[model samples]
Target: MQSNKTQQGGVLGVFPHYHWRATEQEVDMAMPAPAPRPLRLNAEPQNLVIDLRRTAIVVIDMQNDFCAPGGWVDHIGGNFAADRAAIEPLQALLPALREAQVPVVWVNWGNRPDLANMPPNQIHLYKNSGSGTGLGDPLPDGRGNVLEKGSWAAAIVDELAPLPGDILVDKHRISGFWDTPLDSILRNLGVKTILFAGCNTDQCVLHSLTDANFLGYGCVMLEDCCATSSPDFCTQATIWNVKKCFGFVTDSTTLLAALQAPPA
Candidate 1:
């Protein structure tokens, strides 16, 4: 009697083409690709038909430090309320995106505890006066270091805490791609398009979106899902730049509708 046990191939990565399965007799490299999940989104400048299978939503800096009371923004007297606006929209949109099988990437400022990776310029952004609480500085109420990894200042807000399947990337620079594993992670996941959302639209969000654009990824800004404490003009300018130079601009409502609509 012949043995019934047979060798089985194992998947190498998230993508089909790049990964392979190997057995005792043969190695199959041409795995069947999943069908594209295309959705039509109404956006500024023009409309778009994105493949959800190759797309991911990047939520930037939606952490306690930026949105919650007794955090960095609040401690500095910045208008934390403005940044809080993105919370409700995100609450509604993230679950829908997850349901649609779209990857959720949370890119927050999580610096090293020793501040060794930080430069003077980056530190100065938070402490322009060369005094007071800055990056890696302990909060007044002892809420751990500002934006330091594993600290309350670096944790995501409770309302928008990442679920088990969500991806978290700690970024030390304004651009999430700079000196970070974000690009590598997206590449491994076979993501070609990025939907941008989060706080300080003109600063972190805009810079990250621009970096994504430069890296040849399709960029889309979710207007209502991003907030800023800056003047209204700043928000306007960021939207204009995203539409004219960087990428398309749309809101979560439009995206949610697209996700729910039957694929055309």
Candidate 2:
């Protein structure tokens, strides 16, 4: 009889070319997870798991200056509609987040009364941008003033009023952490995860989220509750960068659902 190898014939059509064999270099899909880093560098392995106990919702720059009609964004001839649209979603989300016992923080642009700590560059931007009330200048139509620390424009919008226990942080710069008590407050509260929602997605919201991520906080962006007066592409780019690099991107509904779900 002929040897088996000598008698073998191959078929033209075959479902599998060959049986798979594990090589020494082959990856082990079932390998145990490696130890997490001492600090969270990036928001990879996106998990919607939110611990309401250790989490806080940061409402960034939802002030009248950015969100309301007679504010700075509108002062510079920018359309405030997008910023206005964020209000209802925030209103819907705030109550649930508060009831769930998640801390709420309002971070808004509240410059010094005498413009002492205000950066010259920032002041320049506000001055040359449009023909409206400048920072610390009274609104022409009497809607308080713009960018004065305790003025109506610097306050959180009336619609999303801060409740009794909510944290209020006044920031001089776009990033709330700069020259403000925001970081210390979050640290003191033992907060590890930050849920970011507010107006001007490409500016204040983006800046604050970036700083939070840099400071090692796990960031979850509430997509629907953030907006910008810039072109729609800016908002798109901000969300894209957030999901791709800084943090997890989710909307109010998904976040509410996550918060409502019982822990595993």
Candidate 3:
């Protein structure tokens, strides 16, 4: 290691012009930062031979409690805008996905008051839930079946409401794949890398992506397209967890670009 020093007023800055004498430690401190990695777009849509008829988009837990009026989460100091933004882009993308024959699965959690089928512990947790339960209903039309994780408010919202043909899968926990029909249904429909956008990024979304990865399917967490009970956890999960380990933490722009571009 060799180093040269320059003086600026009262401070010293290291220069590559090393004196004939220098130590390894001095050189290490002056090393340039690593180069930025290039952005990568997933190639699945290009690689697969099937037509647009093959892909399915799974939109998770966007129900009233998580996104709209009369939702219990709002009563508990939750931020609505944090989750609502997911709606605009998704709504904007719907027409294209629909015309392309990609199935849009709307999943919401709901439970019965008696907790008839759920465990006692879960039943206790959902005791006061008003939205996720059958109390108010998950889907606006009640056409597509709703999967109630309901001990109380596990339902998806009415804003980006479910359509008559949208498939609904139920779950009792955060990861939609945990003890649920999600994996089976996706496999049946031939969904590989699911383009997901929904509520509570730190928990459900993160859990779902981890499961999706372990299960061998690809996953991407749309960054600006998700929210949590707290903004901090939302950003942390999207930036650190999803970006570093679980999956690609991308955005709506990249998604729409991938959608419009011809399949690879």
What does candidate 1's lDDT look like per residue over 1-264, in tens digits?
011123233655544424667677778877776678788889989999998888999999998999999999999899999999999999999989888778899999999999899999999988899999899999977898999999999999999989887899999988889999999988877789999999889999999999999999999999999999999999999999899999999999998888888756
TM-score of 1: 0.93
* Candidate number achieving the greatest lDDT relative to the actual structure: 1
Q: Can you tell me which runs of candidate 3 are displaced by over 4 Å?
A: 1-54, 120-155, 262-264
* Candidate 3 per-residue C-alpha lDDT over 88-145 given as tens digits, one digit per residue, 9 for 90 to 100: 8777776666765567876556554344656655544544553354332344433322
Considering summed lDDT, which 10 consecutive residues are worst modelled in model 3? 10-19
| Model 1 worst lDDT run, 10 consecutive residues | 1-10
Off by more than 4 A, model 1: 1-9, 14-18, 24-27
Q: Rank the models by lDDT, top first.
A: 1, 2, 3
TM-score, candidate 2, is 0.79
Report the number of backbone clashes for model 1: 0
Compared with the true structure, the alpha-carbon lDDT of candidate 2 equals 0.75
Rank candidates, TM-score, best first: 1, 2, 3
**Compared with the true structure, what per-residue lDDT tens digits does model 2 show for residues 1-264?**
001233224311111111122345663333232222122212323655545556789998888887777787777677877787788989999998788667799988887778887766877767776555677777767766687778887888889999887888888887888889998878755578898988779988999999999999989888888887788899889988998889888778776665566653
The candidate that wins on TM-score is: 1
